[model samples]
Target: MPRISRSEAEQNQADRAGPEFLEALARGLRVIQSFDRDRRQLSLSDVAKQVDLPRASVRRTLHTLVQLGFAETDGKLFRLTPRVLTLAGAYLLSNPIASILQPAIDRLSAEINASCSTAVLDGDDVVMIVHASPSRILPLSAQVGFRIPAFASSLGRVLLADLDDAGLDAFLARIQPHKLTEQTIVDKKQLWQAILKARADGYSLADQEVEVGFRSISVALKRLDGRTIAALNIGIHTERGTPEMMRQTFLPKLRSLASELQQQLI
Candidate 1:
């Protein structure tokens, strides 16, 4: 999945949604997105405030979710049910890339004793589709479905490099890049230059840009037609190596793995 700017993503959604679009269904999905790892459970008023919908509408939506086994309520707070995993499971099962990439990623993570992941570009972000971590660590780990800003992440830069000039302009227009860490590049011109460098180098490296003491290196997974389908990355603690080591050691491995994965895709 090539990276799409926020404006382009919105336009795509609008194009797919004809006049027969179901507003209620859209609202229901928004309600689902309101719940996250930090805010696992929310009251009706909380959800209404989060989604900016009326309390009545949120209540109805929550009730429908509970009835359909997507959510559960403990009389006061609403939380997503395990049944919701069905949706993620269905997506993983349906996407051959996700399913086929996991085992190889797991092997890579084990071999390097680091974190490895595959992600697809979404609107202004990259969403992890497959994630493997040494010892399956959780804290400070980016799990499947985790999203990171595309401008500051190595995986994101690789994916963003695939976009053409017009697509890149549209993305920059919609995204106001912010400094996540001291090393983060927020200026549009500077970020654009970084992207261009990644395009020329065939890989991207982010050293503590997303988070201090963390580093990542990534390569784009391209189809035979030269279309970027996803990005593959390896994450490590800053103590593990230097930028030169990452470029010389990990970069080659990531490129090889990305090439292997691309060959597996149609």
Candidate 2:
């Protein structure tokens, strides 16, 4: 390799100091995300392809992550360790809303006999912060640190509704809408209309977008200045209840819980 200019190297270092500082870290996290319930253990090549990174860079990053205990490898395959919880748990602990509201969320789950989830908007996805469910299993995936597309879930809609016109338009511009299920909304105009309604009514419902037989209702938890800090949602099995029931029965309780949560923030 040839020697590089000092100024060029300096500029690169400077770029790594601000918002751009996290590019490598972001790519590493994406690599971890590539390993999910379906793809739990991956080889170096597998991680590279999943994250769209060059093999050499991905290898270096993975080696570092393994050394730091964020990941584990058995010569050929790599998997995340339980220690990975520390990263997400740190975020939950540092965020006042998530810390303060977990007990209430657990109570809601216990009372409803359904799954309750809390999430924060992470780009165009809702990143699950806290999820509490009954001892009995549910039809949908509800776990801490899971993420769902913001356009396709009720939890997503509540967070989306908080965005202003410019933010909404920008988000809409980037997404290539697809039908995850027959009920998934693919039209941008219709989505905008739905979000507007959610903002007005203070709750949103998803009748099986990500999963075919599951439905969820959500409301945004707002700060005193009216910014949405997080979303709280309940997922119900569609076979057990009608959409009308979610609206008529669960929606009121969801609203009341959200209202109470907002007061705690103030």
In order, candidate lDDTs are 0.88, 0.84
Superposed on all Cα atoms, the candidates' RMSDs to the truth, in angstroms, are: 5.5, 3.7
For each candidate, what TM-score against the reference?
A: 0.90, 0.88
Error of 1 at 119 (Å): 0.1
Model 2: lDDT equals 0.84
Instruction: Please provide, for model 1 over 1-266, each residue's C-alpha lDDT reduced to its tens digit, 9 standing for 90 to 100.
Output: 23323245445776798777766787799999899878999999899899887677788899999999999999999999988888889999999888889999999988888899999998888999999997854425368988899999999999999999999889988898898889999999999999999999999999899989998899999887778999999888888899899999998999888788777787
Best model number under TM-score = 1
Model 2 per-residue lDDT at 3: 33
Candidate that would win on lDDT: 1
Candidate 1: which pairs clash?
A: 1-229
Q: Tell how far residue 97 is off in model 2, in angstroms.
A: 1.3
